[model samples]
Target: MTVLHEKLRGKDTGYWIIQCTNPLTHKRTTIRRNPKTDAKFKTKRSAQEFELQFLKSSMDLNMKFSGLFEDYCNYLEVHKSGKSLIDMKSRYNRFFVHLKNKKIVNIRESDMNLIVRDMQSNGYHSSYINTIITTMKILMNFAVKKGYINNNPIANYPKLKVAKTNDDLKFWTPEQMKQVIESIPEVYKTAPDVRQIQHIIRFGYFTGMRYGEIRALRWKDIDFNNNIININNHISKHNTERAGRKNGDYHQLVMDDDTRAVLTEIYENHKKQPEFTNDCYVFHSATRGPYFPLAATTGNKYMMKLAEANGLKHITFHGLRHSHASYLISIVGLSEAEVADRLGDTVAVTSKTYAKFFNQARVRAANKISSHKLGF
Candidate 1:
């Protein structure tokens, strides 16, 4: 039932009355709303949405968000890696705490919008908010599957639109990389204690490896004869070595001249010290333990500081991998399969990620072929 008040006591007044009955339980519910305060519940369209959501949530007192989210986390634990589970648990602690005790049916599109606004206003990136929403939606959809709720009300509401094209990617050009590297103080580049930072940066650009994968590297993992650098594991945020890369399999980066030269420099620097062994981390942080790789934060912090000081564009540590992929696709013009082999993704996945670059390549190819003169 919908009712709109036109007047009260001869003064102009407008408000909405939402009334509904539970089909399953024969329970009556009514909500009176003033458009001035509750914008989400003001219009007839949104009033009906509120009616449906409130009725569903009121019907079942036990379908709580906390309980359902815990169930979802249990499901994720069995499927996701430990590190990934920890990350999600952190998100739960940080952002999802407020939603914990609410009914599953109570979560709404408007609520999600509020969350997006709050996160954005608090300086959270769209990508980071995307992850939070993705995790939340996974729980909501799972609730629907388990019959905990009638349906996910927020299902149709799309996420914050994020730019996905090459122009939006934050990769650095080859020249920018050179400028940032060269701007480093000479002593920082020469001293073994600090040189690891520069070496790690160069190594990441030379071979498109994730910071975790690069940090986890061992001299023994490198096979000079086979021309392969095996990526089999990573150093977790907790400083413990974990097995298997993010892609869930062993990947190899074939050694090109640049990669070989970078490795040669790293090895020469390491062999000068007595602790150097095939078992040692390839990028060791002397400030920490010689046995431990640079804590993921160290490299990231250095990059931020270096960027601020040098007037260089802040290419995130992960952007090094993007730089490598962009260089391979747009500069070297490698096939998708070739890039995938180096990047450790399937060709289809790689093509979708770098679709803008691939599209440009197609245009260039067509133009080059069409330039051939055909005399009639």
Candidate 2:
């Protein structure tokens, strides 16, 4: 039911106020306007028509934003990797800190724009801000599918532009990579876990496997008979637990003799352990006894300390993957498609990412052309 009240603002001024009960919240919401400036009823009949229209619009309510957000997080736990779920939980926590239990139906594009503008004003990078915005849009779409909202208000929200730079795309030269690997302190190299770190660095350089895939490698994945290594699962960095690789499919690549020998050496060392089994992690932790895969920070921290000590260029573990790509194209003379297959990437992506290396290859091929001319 809607009720209208005539209130006297002053001796001569009066305003029309309409109050309607919200079905979802069970609270009354009031709308008031000065009768002279707006709401010129014209007649009792016309005023009743306008009052009905306004009350219907005001009383409509959708699900609460906080309630829907919880539902989305619950879904993520089952369907997403633990690390990804943690990242989303963090991003959403920052978002709800600002929005604070607003109704999903009442959220507007302008509100989203304001949030983005606020992030930009605070000096956050465009890419990070864009990721937050993308997460919000994902939640809103989920709400729509659940029939909480009629449509996504910010579905087409614009993403902020970020500048591109080669620093992010940097890859180590083969000489630099060799120097860095050789520079690991000899004392650390003798330690059991440090030996595994040494193996991981070299394996990343030769194989180009992502950090997750490399850490998740097991004894069973090594096909010594076929001279190939299988990449079937990955460990999420946040919880240090196994999950399917990023591509969610099994990948296999043949190893060169040097890589095979390195794996064999590690395997032989592990076989000395009476408790070692085929299911054990290839790079087991040292301090945590045996069979536990090294924590995600182990390789990253090792590379950082080694680079600082050796005065070499600071490159993370992923840099080792990029170094492998560069080595294959520039030195090994492998074709783009072949390199892509080895790296578990599509050919188009390989070509796009290593366009400079491909161009150099083209120049090398052109140099072999003879100057002899034939009549057409």
Candidate 3:
């Protein structure tokens, strides 16, 4: 292979030229650089090493810091369709604000440590610190491939050790569930708008659907004949300075009979209304569109009010999902695999996080067997 012509331009003070042929295609290519602006290389051998490094990086999946971050956000936007790019952009902006006026290549391990220390001083928990560090590592790895930096400074940073606090895994008992359902006001039951909201809560307890999935439900995804509810979508709220925007799309999940019944009832009721006959959303607000998934703060506020009114202890709406899973394992005596399948979680997750609930059920079963043996 013949080397391409090398143009030794400038005052021989900073710049150099490299000419070489493509290893596979044998095509000739030339690269020009100003060594002063780049990292220093004294000897010809050192220059050759730098040239090889550049060539390798050019062929690999690398990107400049800004470019890599933008690409990463784009990837998240496409793959995580339920999430909005604007939300990611906000997170990126918050992280970048701390890194202003600093080159991506110059970010050192001490810089990350200082950031964590500052956050800790402001009373942020270690978990939140871990999230920031993980995000930084992802961005750094992307920069490494682009040849912006030779190494990831935060790659080996120690994770914050967090101790387990109170096992606040509270769930509604069968009696409590009955009481809550029976306590629904007659006015809410009669009102078409409020009735569906109540049903949404009940369905969440019965089927363990996430808040986003419940809001995004459509009449088309339900099958009354087969008693199947296809949980392929979620509604996400994109908060802004103005009114928040709501978006929905398909996602993976699990479903059951009670969920289907609640959906069918809601669907049939909506079908009877002339204005809602062709409407696409299952749970629309008074504004003639699907209800935006409630923000975490707003949802928690309403949940607390509901708990207070019903004379129940405060629990998150997400607690309803946990309650359902707990009931399946404890009262229903379902295996971990069965519970995991119904709850749309892996068996490992079911066993690791929820296995303790099953222990109580097992003890109860053993006691019953012992009583039979003793003829009592």
Which prediction has the highest TM-score against the true structure?
A: 2
Off by over 4 Å in 1: 1-113, 117-125, 130-168, 186-194
Per-prediction TM-score, please? 0.61, 0.61, 0.54
Error of 2 at 61 (Å): 14
Which residue segments of model 2 deviate by more than 4 Å?
1-111, 114-126, 134-167, 186-192, 238-244, 368-376
How many times do residue backbones clash in model 2? 0
TM-score of model 2 (CA atoms): 0.61
Cα lDDT tens digits, model 2, 274-349, are 9999898888778875677778788788888878777767878888888899899889999999999999889988
lDDT by residue for model 3 over 110-181, one digit each (tens)?
A: 988887888788988788778888878877886565445678888998879864332656667777877766
Candidate 2 clash pair list: none
How much does candidate 1 score in TM-score? Answer: 0.61
Worst 10 residues of 3 by lDDT: 239-248
lDDT (Cα, 0-100) at 109 in candidate 1: 83
Clashes of each: 0, 0, 4
Candidate 2 local Cα displacement, residue 119, angstroms: 5.8
After superposing candidate 3 on the true structure, give the runs of residues whose Cα lies further than 4 Å from its correct spot: 1-126, 131-170, 178-192, 236-261, 275-279, 290-301, 308-313, 374-376
* Per-residue error (Å), model 1, residue 81: 22
- Local accuracy of candidate 1 as per-residue lDDT tens digits, 1-376: 1233322332223545665544344466656663356453445666555655553555444556777767677777898778777887898888888888787767888778878889999998788898778877887888776555777887777777776666556777888888777866652666555556667778888898988888899999999888889898987766677888876788878899988988988888778888778988888777765577777687787678777867777878888888899898878989999999889999988998888878888888889888985866
